[model samples]
Target: MSLDMSLEIEGEIPDWEALDNAIRSVGVINYEIDRDYVFQGAFKKSDGYFWLSKRSEAQRKTVIAEGNHGCSFCVYNAIVFRINNFYYDDFVEDMNSFLKKLTSLSSMQFVLSFQYEDVYAVRNKRGFEFFWDQPR
Candidate 1:
């Protein structure tokens, strides 16, 4: 089974010439970043199931982009990305913290997962963070 994680943020994404810039900025060494920003050797490198944005071109345009920017992925959001099924917490946390530091505007998050369930980390107008579950 493959596990997926996505970082969803709005506003002020840090400029990175390559995905390596972001990966290195987070201080995770030993993982190779490719030109596509796809997972190369982090986890499950031998398995084809562990692929991010596995959707076809037409499918990705419809499903992932949601008509926003015409199937192009924004750095602020990573949808359906592949990672180790059991060992993705560090990745998620690091991504969250990395994004939070890019701007002073604060942020919120909505994550839907089949294994971990749906989680929303919301940053309110008061500049505080809160968590809630969806589909209640």
Candidate 2:
């Protein structure tokens, strides 16, 4: 079991430096990003990893074509994190900090799962907005 967090980016594209800083801030390392800025790597804080990727326009269309009618809310770019079920407290603390950092970098739709309960939110210059008192 793991906690999943997805950030759908909006407006300007995030630069590698910003992404690197965010990823490192969460205790992730030895990652690599392609020209498209898609990246994946393990977390130094625990037994988990993350992947950030963007779908091409054609790919998004294909998902729609395949019958995911709600795909409209899905964006071309997203950063997804998979935190392993170990040291839940540490993960929550780290993610709280990471989410706060992200707010200053970009505007995004944030989706997070806590104990299998998912909550949708928006992250902007103001901050991350959602409520989930995850059990430790």
Candidate 3:
């Protein structure tokens, strides 16, 4: 079983340095790239980079994605990141901090969607907040 979190932010993507720093707040990244590491000073969208978290033993990857992506919900014109398969026990807190750090980099609002096991949740700055929703 894996945990996945997606962050959707409006407008242009933040610079790679800022994104790197914010991601490091949760764990140390392995940073695997082959000439695709940076793009116009921002993270190259849809690329997945592997990482290791200090809080968990599991190894995982985080992907910089583009456009709107939610299973049931929708967020448009956003720069997205999909942090995948992190089994940290205190992940919810870490995600909250991650979102806060990202929000600080720019004035754009953020939308976050997370899933673990049977639970799925969405948290956003511009309203549309919801707790766990288990599928029927």
Residue 135 of model 1: what lDDT?
19
Q: How accurate is candidate 3 locally (lDDT)?
A: 0.38
Poorest stretch of ten by lDDT in candidate 3: 52-61
TM-score of candidate 2 versus the correct structure, residues matched by position: 0.64
Q: Write the per-residue lDDT of candidate 1 for residues 1-136, one digit (tens) a residue.
A: 6555443323223232334444445555345545554543342222212223334334322113221121222223333445554555655565455344432333332232333334333222344232322311
After superposing candidate 1 on the true structure, give the runs of residues whose Cα lies further than 4 Å from its correct spot: 7-18, 36-55, 62-92, 101-136
Index of the highest-lDDT prediction: 2
lDDT of 3 by residue, 1-136 (tens): 4434545444333344555566555554444322344321212222233231121223122222332323333223232234333434344445555555655564444444442222233333443333433321
Q: lDDT tens string, model 2, 11-48? A: 33555566667767877767776776668887677646
Better of 2 and 3 by lDDT: 2
Candidate 3 accuracy as TM-score: 0.42
Q: Which regions of candidate 3 fall more than 4 Å away from where they truly are? A: 32-86, 115-136
lDDT of each: 0.36, 0.56, 0.38
